[model samples]
Target: MNSLNSPWAAHFIQTGAGNNQSFEQAGALTLENIKTLFAECDKPYSGLPPSALKKAIYSSDLSQVQPLEKVIEQTNRLIAKNSIMVQHPHCIAHLHTPPLISSVMAEFYIAALNQSMDSWDQASSATFLEQFIVDWLVQTFSLGADADGVFTSGGTQSNLMGLLLARDWFANTHSQHNIQQDGLPEYGHKMRIICSDKSHFTVQKSASLMGLGERAVVCVKTNQQGQMDIDELQQTIEALTAQDLLPIAVVATAGTTDHGAIDDLHGIVTLCRQYGLWSHIDGAYGGALMLSEKHKYRLKGIESADSVSVDFHKLFYQTISCGALLVKDKSNFSSLLYHADYLNREGDELPNLVDKSIATTKRFDALKMFMTLKSVGAQTLGEMYDKLIELSAQVADSVKENDHFELCCEPLLSTVLFRLSSHYQGSLSSGEFNQLHQTLRLQLLTSGDAVIAETKVNGKLYLKFTLLNPCLTLSDFDSLFAKIESHAKLLTNKAL
Candidate 1:
């Protein structure tokens, strides 16, 4: 037998290929196992450490069949042992939530089909489905008739695609497409991108990857609430033009990472139109909130953007790696088109995803969102956001009332920043306040009872809570704080 052909793979496959009775027995056994596992994991929600996983029972040789089987069993045991239970009411760390159950089941079929989405010939209906979804999203956001876009791995990739498209669009119009093939030659002026200071660092990184140095991303000052200051932005643009620099694009953040603060899209859009600069919205975190009838006004001018990036995984209750970029003009995608004699037709009538994206192979991310949308509709998702916003307001009010914690900033979207008030004194130096903030976050994570995020506000570190889950309540934070208090005491004792 070839050493590469391991019997362990055969054994695993054989286990999956089962009779009706075998499935019944397996189902019964799995339920029993899950129940027992949940019981052991229920109390304390989580712990510092459970126990080191049992050592591998297999030898190094690939030909060792029985020992390899034992190793597989041990690995499965460990995977089934612990559950983060993000769906449970207790979880409140990163931006996460209980995904739609239907999408979870659809993923199995998507995986089995293994369709290549680069070309219509490769995927047929799958390719059309992806295009239709992108089209639908454009319509939903009210992007103009010129709107078009492509799916990406996530926000980072989506941001990169936006910058790449803007570069191609600008250069093509300015120099008759010289940069695409000849590269930047006889460049008339240095290019620059304007974005809020609160914008994600990914914007700067994307610029760097696109041959635009990090210095190309100019950070416009934001207001106290983290919203971009329109006046400051206008002044910056004017200053750049005065220096004979080419202003390529203005990136407006729909929901900032730390605070969920949405910049004034209307103001940014007006400025972009007035200056003839490309306008792109990095809405990967908050763009989906457009579904909310109540909170939709927060992102009023998003429909006017030249391009928009949205992440379905963040607030749509979908699995990760589902992100999309929307462009107001489909022709802009032509700038990314490539031809391979073996892969694509010379004049393909059908929409090829690869023509519009930086990636050659794309996942069926639309299926999950499609299943979720069809089953429940967008309005339900909107209601979920409304509920979360209301819950966050309640949490903020509670934080304000509590003498122990201080609300560092008002609730923006679904995140709140607060820190311990116990450390506050009649007069304390900024250095001392910063130390207290660091100590508080360290205490929470080390305790493992609850995990809270932290961020800086006006140079002071403050604990941040991102309320992505609609099901969580203020009572949940009450429970979270009780654990924090206990952990803080333990940490303080150790420090003493």
Candidate 2:
């Protein structure tokens, strides 16, 4: 028999005729495994400890095929022991959320169909549906009829896309410099993207990737709450202009990482207009505020941004890796559009998604959001976010009342930053104080009863509560805080 035509080789091809029976069994088993794992998410740390995982992983044989029942049971057990239980109220770490059941169902379908979004031919109806979703998002931003966007991996990719288009458009608009073709023009080395010091680090990374050094990201001073100081930004722009440096874009962060501070969007956009700079908003965390009737006003000038990036996974309650980059004017995407004979041809009109995005062979992650909105409705999600925000405020109040803790700032969106105040009475230095807070975070993680993020503000360590779980209540937070304070005192006593 020919090697290619042999049953063994053909079964690996993934075509229905070759592997349909095997695929069906595997798919069913995987779904059942997921259900079993998800059922155990009430625990703070559902995963096994490091030592046990290492032992099991070393013993497992990948080369041998196991029975379907055995495989399913083993997979479910491994997942239950290893996965972070986001659904648990005490697991309020990072910007992660327990994905909605409706959206999880959508994810299963998205995976099963395996729709790729690069071109028209690969995902015919899916391509249009993605476009429809993009249109809906653009409308939500009130970005006008000419607005367009593409789904990305997450905030990082979306932010990269935002800056990439801005970089090219700025080059072309200013001096007819074709950034894509010319590599970097004479002054491209001096290209600057200004944003708050509190802005996400992705901006500086994007600058570095774009051949503009990290120094090209000029940091404007932020206020106590972390919003950019417009006066300082103006002064910095003037100083840079005096130095003959070119300003490519102004990246206004809608929600900062550590502080969750929303920069003055209207103020930032106004500056961009004056400086002839493209405005980009990294609304990755706070962008879901648009869904809220009560808080949509917070992002007042987001409509004026040249481009905006928002993540569905963060606050919009979708699963991981669902984000979009929206441009005010669809023509901005032309900078990235490329033509190929077999894929996105020049003459064809079937919505070639590859034209607007940096990625090819993209996942249909947008379907998760689409299904979420269709089933749960936007208002419902907004209310969920509002509830979390409210819960964060209660946590903040609890922190303030406790002498063992110090609130860093008022709760903005859903994140709360605070730190320990060990009454150790050992003439402790500030650096020692910082170390105690770090120890507190580590202790909690090792205990596996709670999960919370830790970040620094102004070179000082602070504990964080990123409350993306709407199901959590003040009682859950009370328990987590008690754990935190008790753990800190225990560490302090150990030091004594």
Regions more than 4 Å wrong, model 2:
1-28, 46-55, 422-425
* Candidate 2 structure quality by residue, lDDT tens digits, 251-319: 998778888888889998999999898999999999899998888899999998999999998888888
**Model 1 global lDDT (CA atoms, 0 to 1):** 0.78
Instruction: Compute the lDDT of residue 218 as modeled in candidate 2.
Output: 95
User: Which candidate has the highest lDDT of all?
Assistant: 2
In model 2, what is the error at residue 303, expressed in angstroms? Answer: 0.6
Clashes of 1: 3
lDDT by residue for model 1 (1-496), tens: 8432564433322233332343354445655665666565542234334343222223234575564335444434655544455655545666765677767756765775678778887788888888888888998899978888788878898888887888878887776855667776455338889999999999999888888889999999888789999999999999999998888899999999878899999899989999988899999888988899998988999999988999888888888778899988888887777787756778767767787888888887888888888997899999999999898888899889987778877888888888767545324577766776677666555434555777888887778878888777778889887776666555545544
Give the TM-score (vs. native) of candidate 2.
0.94
